[model samples]
Target: MKNVYLDNNATTMIAPEVIEAMLPFFKDLWGNPSSMHYFGGQTGKHISTAREKVAALIGAEPSEIVFTSCGTESNNMAIRGSVEATGSQTKVITSRVEHPAVLGPCQQLKNKGHALTEIGVNSSGQLNMADLRQELTGEPTMVSLMWANNETGVISPIDEIAALVKEFGGIMHTDAVQAVGKLRIDVKKTPVDLLSLSGHKLHAPKGIGALYVRKGTRLNPFLIGGHQEGGRRGGTENVPYIIGLGVACDLAAKNMDKEIKNVAKLRDKLENKLLATCPNTSVNGDRANRLPNTTNISFQFIEGEAILYHLSDIGIAASSGSACTSGALEPSHVIRAMGVPFTAAHGSIRFSLSRYNTTEEINYVIEKMPAIVKKLRAISPFV
Candidate 1:
């Protein structure tokens, strides 16, 4: 009964190297970065080093990086901060399939009298650029779209979107939490105004994230307590986790090419095998432009929660896009946005792989998943 975890999108196992890099900060060098003494100075230097590492991973300047609690905070800061900085504008634009981090803040703003335009996606889960162009007709305060879909792993044309936002005189931001390590990110190349990433999504410990602000992007501070994070964010930094995240980013930069090729091969093998073994199944999203290490498959006429329970019995971990697991009556917003049929949308399961995942683990899941699905469907009333 081996434990095979494929739910990297929810969180990932912290890498041993990252833990090793972080241990010293927790043990001997636990000083407030703002302290005036030598101990604080040493810790502060490490923070600066960590900042450089994170910035390098995304092709940003160290000055442009601002550490925050997690991806949610970063997203909020990027959305709310940019809008507030540009006081004259009153509109924010984003897509229908963004993670709740971005969507939640936008909805909150909409409730507070700000105009919010949520662009729709096609049946393939790709954004309708025409709709985006129409929304950008006005002087939008900001446009926040995700670089990748967490459930479907669909990669968006963020570089193109950023260019459009620039033309329309709107600030551009991307929640790149799921895309940061798995894909190549060069802020210089993309020219986005702001970007958010979580450390936990890339084999670093949780509770640490970063926001990248392009130089000269006017953004009001989201958290204003102290002068830390260059007066952009104000809190005692989570020193150890920040150091861990930096190591993880360095590791990601070094290993991304190999990880992409190997993980994609493993993911494709498992997905193809599962689809072949099951009936009335379909893959979600545009398979051609998806994250290399993810596959979302829909099992028609079955409940995803029931399937999850069956898989759990075998020590296999996966995530469901179904509304049943999300405490809702409707299916996944991502699947629904893509126009996935009601029959299939309720049963979509997301399997996200990591660099640590091996062919053996994928094969093990492929061997067991078909039987689990068959058993569940046999008892499903909808079938």
Candidate 2:
């Protein structure tokens, strides 16, 4: 059977160029970046170069980037560290539709007596700016919001939100893991004090990510140990994966136009065809303001897991929700937060694409999905 992987949001296939860039580190330059020896120093220099490449991808200064294990680590570090730096009394503000990584840390803070306010989202998954403005009123706040929704690909008004946070004398952090490679991000213009990104989201290998800390941002270290990541994050660097992340970032920067144009074209074709062919189907989230490579659709009276299983059987991979939240036997928090009805919520499926996707692959999915939805809906009691 032909393999059509539509689950780029969960994790992407590693880019061939990234693999080529990383091989040298594992084979020949296998030295600790923190070591004082010549071999180690050489490896350390490449790490610095990697830092520059990562920074450049988001229009940040190289000194501001700190490497981490993944997006989850970056989010935890940004949220917890900012709260620590501010004090125990810091008010944490976030959206209801955020990834678990952001919500998990905020929940922990709430349990510890810190004030935590979860801003609500509209039916379209747009943030309620008025609610956020009201919550920004009391105490010194640290607002952690995602740049885009992972499930629905709904882009948040980050620039406006960041400006509001700053106006209220609050620190602003964004989980840009999904938005970084898919959308054009320039930290120089966005005014976000902190931003997180995972390398695997952009075709780099897993186990690599970065947090962008603005020059004056007061963030305490999340992991404490011997000086590494400029004493911001502890432990020895994973040099090979770091090198791969850097190369991936560089390629993403170069190919962003193609992602917006070609990948988006393929995604639109797939979405449009499925909608045209199927009955009782509707697209989720805002149609206009979203990532170019993602679409979430809900097929009424059918379960998303069933759709995924059938699609998988056909070698066409998709997702019911965030990979981090998979297997929970419930609708996605993101979908539920947006008030997607129980009928459609259980049936929501996310099809996230990538630059590597082709028109032919999109056509294949388009051809197969209507029948899958129909077959499953035929058995549903709700039907």
Candidate 3:
């Protein structure tokens, strides 16, 4: 049996080029970037170069980029930091479908006496701009939204939302972890005050991510110790992973155009075939505006975990929207937020592709998925 991994949104395989770029930092250039000695100074220069590379990937100035541990840290820094820095403004606005990273901080702030407004999405999983407009009527301290949803692959109208947030004078932040490599993101073009990205989503290692703080954005330090990351984030930098992230960003920039076409083609082929062959299947989210490499499909009347188990047995790796723990099934919050019927929500599966994925792999998945769905449906009482 061939191994097929289609869960790129959960995490991606590290690029070989990224590994190669990171090796020297671990063995030879092991000096701390914060040190003033010649050995450390050389390592510091490498860090600067990596900073430039990461900045270029998002069309941001090098000075605006602050390296952090991962997307979670970046998000916490943006939300927690901005709220603390802005003294009087207590209102924070966000969407119902944002990742835990963004939502967690917002909820935490709410517990600490800040006003929280969660804007809902339509049945199509598009943000309700009317609710957003209503929320923005009052002065909000911050607005944190995801650029693209992880489970649904629905791309938010961030440019428009950011403009609105700007007009309201609220500090805007976007969790761009899923959007950074798959989509073209130019902070210069978008007026978001802060954006967070995880390197692991783009074929870099898991321990690295960055936050872009637009010049003059008021933000308190999230992790304060050393003067690293220009006093925005403080700690000894993970040198090897930082180098790996830089290379990953460079590779992403070079291959982005090709990935936009090839990945989309393969994803569409897989999604179209599965929907056509499998009975009682529906595509989730706003299909017209989504990340090219993702498709979430719901096979009604069956448990998603059962389908995942069967796929695992066949050496085909996939993910379910339903969170199954201790034999209890909790449907995806994202799908539920989109108003997917209870029957379909329990059966939704997300298949996210990457640049490394091939047509053969996609075809193999398409051929096997229908039979798997059918087998599960036969035993499903809801059907």
| Candidate 1 segments whose C-alpha is farther than 4 A from its true place | none
Ranking by lDDT: 1, 2, 3
> On TM-score, who's better, 1 or 2?
1
Task: Provide the TM-score for each candidate, comma-separated.
Answer: 0.98, 0.98, 0.98
* Model 1 score (lDDT): 0.93
Between candidates 2 and 3, the lDDT winner: 2
Candidate 2: where are CA atoms >4 Å away?
Answer: 322-325
What residue runs in model 3 are displaced by over 4 Å at the alpha carbon?
325-329
lDDT of 3 by residue, 1-383 (tens): 88898999999999999999999998999998878799887888888889999999999999999999999999999999999998645699998999989999999999888999899999889999999988886465699999999998999999999999899888999999999999999999999999999999999999999999999999999988878888888899899999999899999999999999999999999999998999889999999999998999999988888899999898888788876722556788899899999889888899999998999898888889888888887887767
Rate residue 367 of model 1 by lDDT: 91
Error of 1 at 358 (Å): 1.2
User: In model 1, what is the error at residue 36, expressed in angstroms?
Assistant: 1.6
Q: Rate the local accuracy (lDDT) of all candidates.
A: 0.93, 0.92, 0.91
lDDT of 1 by residue, 1-383 (tens): 88999999999999999999999998999999899899887899899999999999999999999999999999999998988888745698999999999999999988888899999999889999999988887565689999999999999999999998998788999999999999999999997999999999999988999999999999999989889999999989899999999999999999999999999999999999999999899999989999998899999989899999888889889999888898999999899988999899989999999988888899899999889888888888877
